[model samples]
Target chain A: MTTTDLAQSPAIPRDGDGPVFREPWEAAAFAMAVRLHERGLFTWKEWAATLSEEIAAAQDRGDPDHGDTYYRHWLAALERLVAAKGAVGPAEMTARRDAWDRAVRATPHGQPILLANDPRSCAHRP
Target chain B: MGAHHDHDHDHEERWSEVELRVKALESLLTEKGLVDPAALEVLIQTYETKVGPRNGAQVVARAWSDPAYKARLLEDATAAIAELGFTGRQGEDMVVVENTEAVHNLVVCTLCSCYPWPVLGLPPAWYKAAPYRARAVREPRAVLAEFGVAVPEEREVRVWDSTAELRYLVLPQRPPGTEGLDEGALAELVTRDSMIGVGEPLPPAGAAA
Candidate 1:
C-alpha cells in the first residue's frame, strides 16, 4: 500500500493524534522506525504485524498496558524485523547497544552523543 | 522536591535503555543502508522546532478571539485549521472537540499512536504509552487526576478516540477575566497538555502560576 494509505490505515502507528514525546529518545525511536519504513526497508503491513505481535506478547506477559512499554515493544519489533531481514544479527545489536550504554555514561550533559571513536561505536567499524 | 529528585536514578536508567536501544536500532539500519541519518535528523528537527503544539495554541487563540472563527472551527475543524496552514495527511479529517464549563474533552488512540502530526508535532511518550491508551478510554477521570487535573463532578468528561483517519484536538475553554487580552496574549495561556485535555488553561492574571 502507498504511504497515504498506510497513514490512513489503522495498521501502521502514527505515534499519536500528534509533539508528545516525553523523552528525547522516544522521538529518536519514532523517527528511526518511520525513516526506515519510509525508505522501503519494510512495508507498513510488515511493520504493523510485527508491532502488534510485540504488544500482544507483552499483554500475554501481564504487562499492564499502561503505555510505558509501547516504545519498548516498538524497539523489539523493529529489531526482530531487521534481524530477520538480515540487517544485523542478535549479537551485533547487543554489542552495539552495550557500546551505546557506555557512550551515554561517558558523555557529559549538553553534548551530542556521537558514536564514532567512542569505545562502543560499532556501526562505523569495518 | 527531594522526593522528585529521588526518581532521578530510575529515570536515568530507563532513559539510557531507551536512548541506547534507539541508537542500536538506528545503527543497524544505517549500517544496512536502509535509512538515512540526515533524513531522521531533519524529521527530528522539524518536530522539535516547527509543527508543534505552538501551532495548535495559535489556532485556539484565534478561535477564542474571533467569534466568527470559533463558529467556523466548530462547524468544520479540518477546513478551518487548514486556513491556518495545518493541512496535509495528518490534518485531514481532524475534529476539534470543545471543552465547556460543564464538559471536558480528552483524546486517545487505543490502536496505535495515530495523532495529528501536522499541528501537534509528535505524541509525548505517555500519550503513546499503553497505560494512557487503555485508561483514557476506560477511566479518564483517574488518568486526568494523575495529571493533577480535577474535573468537577458536574462537568462531563468526553474522551475522543483518535484513529488513523480521524484525529481529535481539544479546544480548551478560554480562561475567564482575560477579556482585555489580545489573541497573542491569549495564545500564551494555551498550553500543550491543556489542549490534550489532561490539564486546563491557566486562569487570568496568572492565578495558578
Candidate 2:
C-alpha cells in the first residue's frame, strides 16, 4: 500500500490520539515530537507527513514491514530537523559517517572501533 | 494486518541465512581492506540516506521533559513506550530496564545481537556478536567500569538476557542541570551507549566538564 494509504488509514492515529509507540524508542521519539510541537519547532502534521513520505519511499524500494519501515523514517525526520536548524551541516555529517565506516572496516572481524574524537574533525556525535 | 500462518514461522530460517550471508560479505571486505574507504563513505551516506539517529534522541529528550512518562518508562516499559507513537513489524517487542543507585540494568543478546533496530536504528557491530554479548552480560559492572562508568558495590546489578523475540534497551537516568532545557537541547545529551545502558547520559552541557 502507498504511504498515503498508511497515513489515511483509521488504523493509524490522528494528531492528538495520545502516544502510539510500539517500541520504547518509538515512544521516546513520539515524546520528542510532542515536545517539539509544543515548542513550535514543527507540527505533528509535518512530522507525520515526513514520516509517511519516508515509509512510502521504503515501500517503493520493496520493504513491506511498516514497523521496520518507520525506523528509517524516524532517522530521516531527525536529520531534517538538525539540518533545518543547522545543528550540523551536511558536509560535516558526511565526513564523520565516512570516518566511522572506515574505522569499522579497519578493525579485525568481530572488533568494531569508533574513531577517536578530534577537535578539528568534521564529524560531530549524533 | 493479515492472519498469522504456519508458513510465516518457516520464514525465520531463510532470513537467518540471509543475515549470515550479509555478515560474511562484510567480513570478507573488511579482511581485504577493500571496505575501509568505500564502506566508510557508504556507511555515512547510508545513515544520512537511510537511517537517522532521531529515534534514540527522542527517548533521551522525553525522559528529560516528563517525569511521569519517565517513571512509566522505567516500570512497564513496553506499554509506556507504545504510549508515544512507535511500534510493530521491525519494531518488534521491547523491554526497558532502569538504572538506579540500588539497581542497574544492562542488556545484551548473547546468542546474537537482536537489538530493537526499529527504535534504535542499526545495531553497532560490537552489539551483534559473541564476544561482547557473552562478556557484557557476564561481567556487567566490569564492562561498565572499563567504559569508565563506575557503579557502587551496594547496588544490585541486573543484566537482561536478550533473545530474538524480546529485545532490550537501557533507560538511563536523566542528567543533572538539564531542568528547563527544551527538547532539542535535551536530545543533545543522549549517547548511543546511554540508551544501551553501558553509560549514563552525559551531564547537561558543561555540568560534568
Candidate 3:
C-alpha cells in the first residue's frame, strides 16, 4: 500500500507509555495518533484503554521485552482501527504482506532482494 | 498481485540459489560448532528489532525536519544520531548525505551491507545481498528506476560506497506541499526507501482532499 494509505489510517497506539520508537515508521504511527486526536477520530483516553488491552494480551502470550511488546500491540491496534475506518481493508494489507513474504521466501537466504533492473518492467529504467 | 507472479518466480529462483550458498556456509559453521543455533537466533533478533531500522529512522526523520539538525547530521552523524538515544555496537561511524535538486545520493556497501544500524533499524533484505551492492554503484540510475524513482540526466547521481568502518544513509528532501507541517507530521512522510534516496516522500492523501 502507498504511504498515504498508511498515514490516513487510524492511529494505532503502541502499548501503554512504553518506549517511543527510534525509527521513522514508529514515529509515523505516533504522528498519526496526534493527527487523529486533533481531528477527534479518537481521544487519548480511548487510545490508552485500547493499548492497555493490547499489552495485556501480549503479556498473556508470554512475550518478553515489555516495551517492545507494547509497540507491536500498538501497531496491531492501529492496523485494526484503520481497517475499521475504511482507510484500507485487511484483505488488501494482507495481500501486500503476503507479496513481501513471497519475495522474502524466494530469495536465496529467505531474504528480500531489490530488483531495479528488469528489462521488461517499465519501473526499471537506466 | 498475480500480475507480478512471473517476476516473483524469477526472484524466487534467484533467491533459492543464494539461499543454498548461505545455508551451505551456515551448515559448515554449525557443524564446526562455531555458532550455536540458540545464540544465533538471539543475535538475529537483537540486531533486527533493537538495533538496525530503528536507528536509521531517527536519523532520516531528523534530517527531514531540522535544517540545523541536518547540518549536524552531515557534520557528525554518529554523535548526532546517538543524541536521539541510539548508539553502540554495529553503529560505529555514520555519514549522512543530503538529496537536493542538483544532486542525489545513494548508498551501497558493495563489499557487504555495512549499514548504520543505530540510525536505520534493519537493512532491508535487498541491501545485505550481492546484486544490489554490485549493481548500485555501477548503474545507480538503472537501479533506482526499478523502484519507480526517476532522476533527470542533468542531475548528477553520487553513489556512496559503504565500508565496514563507515556506513551511510540518504536524507531525502522533504516533499513539496507540506508547508507549515510540524516536525512530527513531516517525519510521517519519510519512509525507509526515501531515506535511502531510492524514492521520494509521498504526499499526504488528505492534503489533496
B-chain TM-scores per prediction = 0.80, 0.70, 0.75
Error (Å) of candidate 3 at residue A6 is 34
- Listed in order, each prediction's TM-score against the native is 0.67, 0.47, 0.50
Per-residue lDDT of A40-111 in model 3, one digit per residue for the tens? Answer: 666544555565555556556764322333345655665556556655456755544444344455444344
User: What tens digits encode model 1's per-residue C-alpha lDDT throughout A8-111?
Assistant: 42221223334445567767777877776767777666776687778878888987655657778888888898888777778998888887776665444556
What local lDDT score does residue A41 receive in model 2, on the 0 to 100 scale? 60
Instruction: Specify the poorest-scoring 10-residue window by lDDT in model 2 chain A.
Output: A10-19
The digit string of per-residue lDDT tens for model 1 on B117-175 reads 78677777677666677768867876787788999999999999876568889999888
Ranking by lDDT: 1, 3, 2
Give the native contact fraction of candidate 3. 0.02
Per-residue accuracy of model 3 over B8-88 as CA lDDT, tens digit each: 344434433323323332333344444444555554456545654445655676666777888898899888888888775
User: What digit string (tens of lDDT, one per residue) describes model 2 on residues B39-90?
Assistant: 4444344433444345766765886688888878767666666776655423
Classify candidate 1 by CAPRI docking class: acceptable
Model 3 scores a TM of 0.50
- What's the TM for model 2? 0.47
Off by over 4 Å in 2: A1-126, B1-53
Q: Candidate 3: how many backbone clashes?
A: 18
Please give the lDDT score for candidate 1.
0.76
Which candidate leads the pack in lDDT?
1
How are the candidates ranked when ordered by DockQ, highest leading? 1, 3, 2
Question: Runs in model 3 with CA error above 4 Å?
Answer: A1-126, B1-42, B52-54
Off by over 4 Å in 1: A1-27, A37-53, A64-68, A80-126, B1-28, B31-33, B87-89, B206-209
